[model samples]
Target chain A: MPLRWPRRLGLVGLALPWLLPYAWMVSTSFKTLPELVAAPSAPLPSGLNLDAYAAVFEAMPVGAYLLNTTLMALAIGLLQLALALPAGYALSKLSFRGRGLAFGLVVATLLIPAQVRFVPVFTLLAEVRLTNTMTALVLPFAVSALGTFLIRQALLSVPPQLIEAARLDGAGELTIIYRLLPPLLRPSLVAAFLFSFVYHWNDYFWPLVMTTDDSVRTLPLGVALLREQGTGVRWHIVMAGNVLLSLPALLLFALTQRQLIHAAAGKAAGR
Target chain B: MKLLSPRRPTDPYLLLLPTLLILGCFFFYPLLAAGKLSLYSWDLLTPPRFVGLDNYRALWSEGLLLHSLELTLVFSLGVVTASTILGLALALLLNRPGRLAAFARASIFSAYIVSWVSVALLWLWILDADGGALNAALQRLGLPGWRWLSDPRLALPSLAAVTVWKLAGYAMILYLAGLQDVPAHLLEAAALDGAGRWQRFRHVTWPLLRPTTAFVTSTGAIASFQVFDVVRVMTQGGPMDHTNVLVYAIYEQIFLNLRVGRASALVVVFFLVLLGLTLWQLRLWLRREGAEGQSPPA
Candidate 1:
């Protein structure tokens, strides 16, 4: 219960192991090739360098890829929000037939990995003449089972009294969901948005399956391409690429970390 | 707060429209189409020919799938163990008292933000045969450079190791969230009663962390099953296909072999296996729920 250093030293010592790999990673990212090869337990770079970073953007369509990734992530996040928020509100609050089954179906779909569905999805896209397009990458993920579930949980926390009062006041279902739900569910929505965006930005499987060229590649897929390029593994560029790859989500995590943790913890408590 | 209307009878359905529409077009349709394509041999260019269960029979008999399934199990088990142990350790560590603990949490989760492809790249460099960081370090230390990726025996384990390295932090973050809700006074009380650290942790802390452990472990296991990027980028399921898993096998089936029907069968089987595992987890959850609900006064 004390705030003194020794009282807290054990706790801080616990974090030391976690800090090691990242320190290595960040240290390596900053270190020169000579330094990296010189010692395994090399110290942090004497100073930061931008050469590897510059090469990362130069070697491939890093700029376009980043732009594509952001836009696709944003598009997917917004679309999921648009689709999931309402459907989740409806499923949570509405008295409707087949509601249980609909909810069950969504839960069931959570078990179907995108990899399992990739082949057929690819074929269907080919049939629709949509292969190798950014749309192919983003469209399938626009409505997420995870988002729907999270939003429903958020909506369930809204009082029935609120809905009942709204209905009694001649408010329509759509209006109640848009107005009543958003105000109450803002935190959940924000959490979902950040989660979805970061997740999509980091997703590799679907984009890998759907797109072939660098022109439409997402960041994760782009990073994969660097490996497949057969230029041999370039450590510095790869480190730069990883830093670039992780920066956005890393930044987002840093920014909204408190809220994200709250949401995750709340959900863990079965909220 | 404004209360919007359900005055329109179709509003609810409209609200569900985008979700259902996207699910149907993107998800459900492809799943159904996957089933349909599995029954018929058609590789995009060919006219569809009905070959019901022929593709399924082939993959089942070939041992390609059985091998992949085995590898997937091994890979999942390895990653699950490594991730959980390291993650739990990290979680416990960061849950301690100190200023750097906050920074430690951030740094650990920073690993999660790295794309799998990049993580694979990072490890690939680490395991490179010639002048690789790890190999170079070992040689410098007068030790043998372990041929991690190239050795068939090491391939799956190496993949698992890389995956664990990538995900341990994320799992730690989840467990950290769980740790935060431990009702700290319990630990304080336990300490006052002559309880040593490990005793308190084992009897009180670990028990409370069950839900979080269950969440992290199950999610980690399931996610590991989809370990295609690492396999693809790092080894491409090579070393004589020693590292191949179900996802990459399915990938090879459809893209490389151009066998749509067979690939679809793999899809069905893969989904069923995952579904079975998930159902098992759900059953355990329900039993836990039932037990909790029926428990005597605390």
Candidate 2:
């Protein structure tokens, strides 16, 4: 803890590898196309030129990509929460036959990553003529095993007496779950929602496989396609598109750093 | 534990039904379908033709499957080892209570939350063979500029480096959380016993962080095994297919090659590998928990 300034400087030095790319990204995004071509590796742009940003917006449907990604991520989050809340509550608070089996089933599904299932899932959707639609993006991710598990862990921390007291007051099971438990489970719920939102917002693999239409293509895919369009690499325009793609997740991280870090740690601990 | 006056046997099941249904349709069903589809050759145009064991045999004979598996293993190993070490180091350095430490933590972890495509494009720009910032910096520093992506030998390592960059922050956050639970009293006790700083950390802190290390390494390995977007965007598993991790290979098989049977077989293999890894982690976790339960109080 001594020599605090030196240590802090050293920490900043170490952080440069992680921070520099983002700095360069934003800097490059603001560079004019001619400047970008002239000095591709320049640390700082000449000035805050908006030519690349303008070009990117003109060339690609940046707004639509953002909106599609946001709507898809929101729908996935809400659906996961709606399904997971009851499932978590049942698994944690309620006792019944086959409860252990049901919980085990949920946990077992965690072993299968979506990457492994995408091929068949893609085919199934294509059979139903659902590919290239928003529903295709949302439906497959509707139930999150991790969300259910996390919520279950959160619910287990709540005292049985509270639910019992509610029961004594003749509160319906639906009311107890939908009303009382959600307030107490706010941290987990928020964590689940944020995780789902950030994950799907940034998801490229599923959207890449599911949708070829620009209408349903998410931001990440849109940015990737932006790079592939021209004869040569347009560094400035690509960087501008990337900056746009990264802003939402970065903003989310900034706003909810503590919750996001804790949720991740809780996941690692397998709670 | 019953919250209702008359315990309805089906109440919990009713609550669980929606979740189970979705998982069944989307998760478990597709898993089984992947297995079944592996036995039959199907293109989008043609009906699936049964070719029992042929897809697996063909992959095994061609050796692409094994090669992809090896490349993935190597990639995952490099990523896991590098990231876990760097992550722990970052966690240790940033664990202090101060604004600088907090800022450092947040800044480092910011990369982990960004989309892989963005990370890929960002790195692609940085690692561009011609006119890349990294090469430009190297030339400015009077050093030789190596092809970071195009070279067969350097490409895999480059992708691994990018992955490590993104994932080390994730591992660091987990290690930071683990460091918080290292039981300060134990460290103090060790200090009281005349242990040096290294000795105390070696004996007390390292031993306590075993669970976190296991979690980080296993999860990192699992994720690295399935890396796709970076490879898809940056390399396309090119420069002699050096960077063709399993997932990308599976993707190529399905979409590009239109060999559904082969892709499904690869998926089955990938799932089995993941299942094995998960089972191994579960065993490690259970053993650790058991040891903790039986250990005498300090």
Candidate 3:
């Protein structure tokens, strides 16, 4: 009820505290070790000194890893959407049997930490000789339990009169899904797509455990490897690589967080 | 009419196809094989030997697994409780009208996109104990500087703090959604009834927030139990394995120690713990819904 400049100023003041670490991360990444560990308060690096990034590249193929992650995340997101959309339409719109059991099973799989089967997956991959392949990175994740459920829930809410009219016009299941359902479900689809994109992009455990070779490393693992040799780790190098690993996802999320969060609320409440 | 039904006839099988096939290949088959493998002792480099529960017996007698289980619980409980409560508070505060609400929300969220690896890498420096940002700030404020990640006594809490920082933003979004759905009229009525802010929150707001609470809490618990990245990057189950959690131990068992059988047992036990908790939640939730349906919305 008053001009509470103190509270307003305090909130802004507090904001800087949280952001200081990120500022440090960005600033230190550009600084030399001497500058980073300086005795007194250090000024932010003024220009491009990519020594940390160069160290990251020399220790491992950080570029190839970024490429691998980009390809893997994009592939998994695209392929999962392609399959999940049609199948979700069928699940939510079509009168199919055993749907409960199927939904239950899909939901159950979400609970199972994919880590629980690490040894078995590793052994199976080894047996199939798919180890160290990007296929190994992308295939298992191409089937997303959450995406199917999300799209299915979205489609379930689309008015059935429209579906009936389309079918009355003799539009096949594929057309109904690809044309009618997806358009109405665009909000939900975008939500699911962003979730899937970020999920796979940030996925570290499977990629770490699965791919031993630098040739197939994703961005997360690439940054992890950048942090250290056996003796000492350079924090600046690791932070630079962290920024690289995260920037794309961060950009996408910043652009779509409102839409994504709104859709999530819509879908969750719709259920 | 048919579409309104949660299940469709053939769609269930089709809905299940991807999850089934993938889980079969990646999860179920491996799990069952790991079960079978657990019964036998194998180095994995050579032909497997059929030891038939010798590994289990040895594990029971050794009680090394009991140690890992304790660590796992500590890791999960500490991280889950801190993150969920604090994250929820941040969400509620930022959910109100403010100039910085949008800015704070986005900043917290930016942390989410960064991988756990990145989060750990960043905090490792921030918590570097000597000249890192954390210590620098503490010392400048004339506070005693503590080694955040390296000190064995404080390492686990240090790990928990970093994780909470990383995840609080995501939880904030979940709660922000929940807060928006709360009917403003109900809060106004409470205010008219002489309810203080805390009382209004406790009575009018908190109960309405249950569904969001359920979703966030369940997801948080599941994620925390399966936590590997933070531990791997920050501690590596280290300062001499003082921080060895279940999944990390499972990693060490299979990869480092080459004990596939023991690792499988750890995983199997963990699955039971997670699945058991989830089923318990579902049953309780259903019962709560059923009981509440008999009452008026007010």
Candidate 4:
């Protein structure tokens, strides 16, 4: 499929706007303070340096924020998967009363994003005195509607006979689910995990509203505070913090582009 | 087929228990709580006091809510229009199979997954009034550099621009997926019937992409309304409340002002608006998909 030269040029030209900011971020992150101040518009620094990276740590508790964010994201992802798996399997493979209603309720939750319920959830957490805790970050999102829907879609394609055969061989409920569903649902699991991980990791709104102290602040919040507090903030150092925060999601995306794309594209692939 | 759950009628119920319990507590309870809180006035220090519809009345009479609502509309419209058009155009351009096209798609889509914090901060650097990349480019082109965030006129659009940059990739992926289902024979038939490229896309391709467009636009609208981080970080609803969107306004009301009732009222209003839009989208999707046979929801 040969694309016309003009069309190809247009596509590449359009793509540059998206790429340039990221390039500029990486470029500025390595610039020395003098170079950064001297040429803020410079597309490339005169020489690469790690001084800014070092400054990011000195400026704030970036390490602590990063650890908290990583832990929160991981906990949310794993918990969401743990809950979504059985729910998905039940919807797809098991016959139960009110299954349609349960599924409908799950899908209906999609209509209301977490932002809409921010106040109540915050109040509830505060009432429980769990504000500023890691649990504050992860508990609300432990059972994901989107995760359940996707996993169910994935499981619908799996042949029910396999589960039946296993059950007929004296396999218990746990055995059939654990032994048969894991391999079958691996792609959906990966897709859901990555989605949850990326969402929770970069999530700033929830963490911002929930946590007041630097001890509980995530990287994004840390960067936000760095900007707010540091009146004469250094762009290079701040960009270094931004780069460090974005690196994991970027790396994961690079490694799992296929699964991520498929996840968004839905089961149109019919896989 | 063997009856896998012959002896376990309650197996499905057991499996669904955790999900129901969690959602009931966190989701449903909060939903009702949000509603109930909206109907009353309670500063944390004071006992709860019921004020039927007064919060809602104050929200409107105060005018801040109205202003933020208008800003939110402008913001969502800007984002949806830019993302959908750009995304469709890019998807059309990259629909062809090739290494370069795939690379282009991947690179463009990468921005969608990057943290909003990073994107916001990076753009903060790029759009800085004096030393930013954008202004520098303007100077090179013999135009004066403009203050992107500081100017009230430019602040909202500037945030909208960043949003478009980040979200256009997501729209592109959805459109690309939609494009794959446009049967080759239908396209060829249209071509043979004297349909030009634009005509083909307008009549056949675009119509076929109704579901995708619906999904993209609806999701885009909701996501844009919920825009908090970028505004919070970049403008802090500022230069003159030009970038004060709904979610940010709610945050300010509840957290900054300690007006829980007002915040909850805003939440209820926002939820109703989104719910209306979502139901409309679902109706359109179901009708379109039903008419077009059994196409999967994108």
State the displacement of the C-alpha of residue A177, model 1, in Å, after optimal TM-score superposition: 2.4
Off by over 4 Å in 3: A1-3, A40-43, A46-48, A263-271, B3-19, B284-298
Over A1-271, each residue of candidate 2 has an lDDT whose tens digit, in order, gives 4656777699788888988889989998888867767777878888889888898889878889889999999999999999998899889888677889999898888887888889889999999999999999999899998888888878877988898889889988788889999999998899889988999999999999999998998889989988888667588899999999898889999999999998787666643
Clashing pairs in 3: A95-B9, A96-B8, A96-B9, A96-B10, A97-B8, A97-B9, A97-B10
Better of 2 and 3 by lDDT: 2
Query: Which run of 10 residues does model 3 chain B get worst, by summed lDDT?
Result: B289-298
**Model 2 steric clash pairs:** none
Q: Native-vs-model 2 lDDT?
A: 0.88
- True interface contacts reproduced, per candidate: 0.50, 0.68, 0.53, 0.62
At residue B12, give the lDDT of candidate 3.
Answer: 44
Which 10 consecutive positions of candidate 2 chain A have the poorest summed lDDT?
A262-271
Ranking by lDDT: 2, 4, 1, 3
Q: Candidate 2, residues B3-39: lDDT per residue as tens digits? A: 3332477888889999999889889999999999999
Worst 10 residues of 3 chain A by lDDT: A262-271
TM-score of 3: 0.91
Two-chain DockQ for model 4: 0.58
What does candidate 4's lDDT look like per residue over A126-154, in tens digits? Answer: 88999989888888888888788888777
What lDDT score is found at residue B285 in candidate 4? Answer: 68
Model 3, residue B182: what's the lDDT? 94
**Sort by DockQ, top down from the best:** 4, 2, 3, 1
lDDT of 2 at B17: 97
